[model samples]
Structures are given as C-alpha cells and as structure tokens.
Target: MPQEAGLRSFFLAGFECATQRRADGKRLDLLASTRHDAHVAKDYARIREHGMRAARDGMRWHLIETAPGFYDWSSVAPMASAAAEAGVQVIWDLCHYGYPDGLDIWSPAFPERFARFSKAAARFLAEQGDEVRYFCPVNEMSFWAWAGGDMGRFNPTARGRGDELKRQLARATIAAVDAVREVDARARFIVAEPSINVAPNGDSEQAIADAANYCEVQFAAHDMLVGRLNPELGGSPDKLDIVGVNFYPDNQWVLGGPPIPLGQYNYRPFREMLKETCERYGRPVIVSEFGAENTARPAWLYYVAQEVAAAREAGAPVEGMCFYPVLDYPGWENDRCCDVGLFGDADANGDRCVYAPLAEELRRQRVRFEGEFAAANDERMTPLRREAS
Candidate 1:
C-alpha cells in the first residue's frame, strides 16, 4: 500500500499525447488534433472535476528539440504549469513513441540525445515543486518495436527487425532513466509495457511450446529494464521502479489465431494475469491502461475492477487502475472518431461531452474502491479480503 509512495489517487486519466510521423510521412500531433495543446488548463480542470486527482500526459519530443543540442521548453512548460495550477497530479511521458527526425533510432546518438532530453525534462518538473512526480520514458516498447520495426507501421519503418529495435529502445530507456535520476532523484518512473497472453491452438507438443515461448516474449522489455535479461546494457534491479501493465480485450489470444474472449473456457482470468505479472517483477503494478470502445466501456471497467480486486485480495501488489485516453480523439490511421473515452472531443470552449453511462460506472467504482481503502489504516495493505460465510 505505502500510502505516501502511491499516486495522489487510485484512479488516473491519460490523454492522447502521441506525436509521431505517420506511414504517410505526415507528422501527427495528437494534442493538437484533439485541441488539448491549446486547452491544457481546461482539460486538467475537467478531469479533476471527475474525481480523478491524477493523470497520464506526454510531451512531444519532436516539437521541443527542434535543433541538435538545442532545447525548447515553450511547448511543454505551459502544460506542466497548467497541471500544477489545476491541482491535478500528472505522470509526464518524455518520449511517447516518437523522437526527433534527424536522430536515427538505432544510432548511439539516439540514446545520447534522449538522455539529455530526460535530464532537461526532469529538471523542468522538479523546479515546479510538485510533491509526487511520475514519468514514462518510453511508452510501449514491445508494441512500438512491432509496429515501427517489424510491421513497418510507423517511424523507422523497418521490416523483420523488431528485436533489434526493441533492444535499441531498451538502451535508450536505460539511458533516459539514468539521466532523469541525475537531475531529480525523487522522480518516479512508470514503465508501461503491454500485457499480453498467447496460447497454442492445438494439443500438439510443438504448438504448445511455441505458444508458450511467444507468450513469454511479452516480458522481454520488462526483463531488460529490470536487469534480468540484458545486464550488458547497464540494466539492474533499480532500473525497474514502478511497473504499469496495459491490458486490453484483445491482449490475449491463441498464437496465430483469434482472441480468447474474456470469461470463456479458453480465456485466462484477468486476476491471474495481474498476479503473474506482480509475482514475476515483484514491484507495484497498475492496470495503467484499460478501456473498451462505445457501449462495452462500462462493462469492461466492471470486469477489470473485479479482477483487480481479486488480484489484490490474493496478495498481489495491485496499486491502482487508470482509464487511459480519458478523452476521446480521432483514430491514428483514418482520423475517424474512436468514441472510446470517458469524455468526447472538446467543443468550441474546450468543454468535453461526458458519456453518462461511463461516468456513472466510474463513480460507482471510485466510491467502492475508496471504501475498500478506508477500512485499512496501514499504508501497506493487501486487497480487502472477503470473509466466507
């Protein structure tokens, strides 16, 4: 539990702050596309009013470091100040799947530049005098490698080179963490990597082993960060501070097959997944990103909340849950409205239309979780265990 060490609240909202070049070679600034860049203060205010005291937002690396060895705080400083003014605690992401165009991702220069950026960003936030500071240096290393290196979905656009890209990202991440610590020792990091599961479709030995191996691959980035797999890259136990695991409906599937529907015979329980993750890493875990699209959003939260509670009761250090993309935005590929956030896109005044159904469910879960914590005066608490009749 560690009351003082945990986030300002048990729930958090994440904005779509991705700033990256698309397959079409167009640079997409999500904060601008969603109008959050101009309405930073308003967005923070609205999220606070929703009863969430914490948020997950990011900076655009491409915009800030416009020139080599030169830094510009113009775009990011105001947003950080806005969050502080609105009284909303934020987990600032330094590099959200995008870096400067001139810097090659695989080049040693990439890590060098990122480390410098991390130091600068950390100093900026440290000077703000915030009590609790959280950061995600590199978001979703696993997915990014697959998309950018292997699948050619985004930047780097290399094919069949996901592993190489993953390692390069890991190296940069390690460097960034070190640099941040140098500037602000109190800064906490949230290593958010995708949580996934894979299974064999058939009953053959080879199929089962292959499926299991693929499933184990999801932890590669985490292992590297924690000094488990890649000690040669300066990884160590301290590298892994707080782990944030992102899970979605389609996160688990049979290898080379379709998704295993939650609650089905073939599906692994969400509680089991959380427990396994916590046990392996032995650090605090957050369901950092969890939400469904449209009508299923509310139902999805209930199921995830129940599983999180169960995992906590089972002695897993499940710290909290974050409903990511708390604000809706256009799709990355087609710019179509995803309609998946708790609040719709901002109107003319930067006001968002809250989805009543999702908001109600969020309120219910918040009250219930607050009550669960209220009974425990201990900072370190196991989940509220129910008594058997």
Candidate 2:
C-alpha cells in the first residue's frame, strides 16, 4: 500500500472555482454561482461532516487583483478563514483560467504580474496562521492552452497558438512557485492537468499514429514544467511536485471520434493510466478532479477508488482522490443546472442538501482506505517488533 501523502484526508472535496471569460466576452465566477463564496463557512463544515479534511479551492484573480499591482483580499479572506476554522487543508488554485481585466496574457507583463500576485497571496495565507501550504499555481495548463489558445473557446481567444500558450503558462507556473517559496519555504505545489487517453478509430497505421500523437499532447505542459521538453522555460524537477491527474468519464476517446465508453476494449483502465503517470513523473499522484453527473456519481466514485487502489497495489504512490465540484453549480455554456456534486445547490439559509447515495459511497471508500492504511502500518512495524524481541 502507498504511504499517506501528507494531506489531512485520503479523500478530498473540490469546490468549482473557475473564473474564466467565455467566448462571447462574458466572465464566469463559478464560486459565486455556486454560492460557495457566500456560504463557505457552512460549506467547509459540511465537508468535514462527511469526513473530508482537505479540499481543492481557488481564488479569483480577476476579482482579487482588480487593478495593476494592487490586490484586495476581500474576495478570498473569508474563504481562507472558513477553511482554517473548519480544520480543512486546502490546495488553493492561484489561476483557474481567468486574469485581471487589463492584463494581456500574451505579453511579458502577464507572468511578472502573476508572480507578484502569487507572492502576495502566499504571504497573506501564511499570515492567516497556515503553517503548511499547498498551491496549484496555474490549474490545467494543457486544457487551458487548447481551449483558450487553439479552440478560441474562452479567454485570450487565440487560434492555433496552443503550444505558445502552454509555454507561457509554464513560465508563469515556475515563477509562481519561486515567488511562493520566498514567502513560505514549506509550500508544496500541485500541477493539475487533465489525464486523457486517445485510441485509434481504426487499425490503419495513420489512425494509430495520429491517436498516439494526440495522446502524447496531454503531457506537454507537464514536460515543459520539469525542463524535460523546454529547458529555457526555467522548469526544474522541483517545480513539478505532486502530479494532480484530473480524469473524468469522458477523458478517454478515439482520436477524432466519439468518447470511449467505460468497459469497452478501446477504453483504458484508469489504474494503468495512473501507473503510467506515476512512472513518468516519479511524483506522488492525486486524482485532482473527478466526478460524474447525476445518478452516475456513486458508480463513478467506486470505479475510480477501486482503480486507484489497484494502482497503489502495483507500486504506484497514489495518494489521494478528490471529488471535484463537490457542490453542484450552473453549467458554463447554459445556465442550466449541472447536477454533478455530492452536495446540491445552496439554499436561502446557506445550506446544501447532501446526495445520500454519493455521500454513502464516500463513507464506504473512506473506511476501506482507513483499513488499508492501518494494515500497511502493521506490516511496517512487524520488523521493528521482531528487532525489539
């Protein structure tokens, strides 16, 4: 079994904190949409009730840094304070696809300004009495690059500049890590990137090669961060600390084809994927973001937890699993409800109704992990007992 990854809990909750601009120039504040910002104290307390003592949350750069070189913590302090009070260890995302209004993402000033913001944020968190800090400097760089830079789906809205945007994000991530370390040397960083699998549509050589190449693209941001691909970007091994693999039900697909259904021959088992990621980076792995919609929630969690356990048995240091968007929020494109969380939308009194089935599954998995950890501890102490005898 794998050792604990220093988190307060093996299972974590993730609040959707995306603050990105849409293609039509509309800015999204998912934190506000989910009412997590207003009801964070109750939200944190609720997760703790479910036995989750850690979480993945975010700060809105666009809201915090309204102007150049000035940051107003009014938007973040309440959430941070709530987490501290609830005894939840949080991995805060510094950037989740949004930036300040006047900051040009393509210019050199982008990374410089981001570094300063990161430093300030770190200092502020430390001042709040957080001894150990975990930060995801820039969330999902690979996905962000493809969506915003290549597909023009969101902010920056550039076409055919995916690689360029990825490199820029990598630079900013490295700079953020350095800046944060200056304030808190014990700070750990998580690089959250989508974990995907692409298979061939047909047996043709061209199809196979295309599928393989497309699958390889998922690692570009991670590679750039560790100097494995781009040494000039100031990437080093330490910059890529914990590999936060964000997998979803639709993460695997045939190249240029439809998504591979679970249990299909073309669909890769998540355990194999986790093992591959661990071997590649040699870093502690965490399921950074994962959950399914509506009725599929419990089944999806069971599948992921089982696969994660299998991977750990195979010598992969799989640490933790996070159920992302633990609170349901409005869909990005349409304002319709996306019923994908363990907790439903907040009510008037700042309360959320828990989805009983998913919550029950989480408790079951937590008990199983606790048993495994205890067994592993006993195995480790056996030799010590013999020595003492």
Top candidate when judged by lDDT against the true structure? 2
TM-score on alpha carbons, each prediction: 0.93, 0.94
**How many pairs of residues collide in model 1?**
1
Show model 1 residue runs off by greater than 4 Å.
1-5, 372-389
What's model 1's lDDT at 329? 84
**Model 2 lowest lDDT segment of ten:** 380-389
RMSD to the native, candidate 2? 7.6
lDDT of 2: 0.89
- Per-candidate Cα lDDT values, in order, are 0.84, 0.89
Q: Which 10 successive residues of model 1 have the least lDDT summed?
A: 380-389
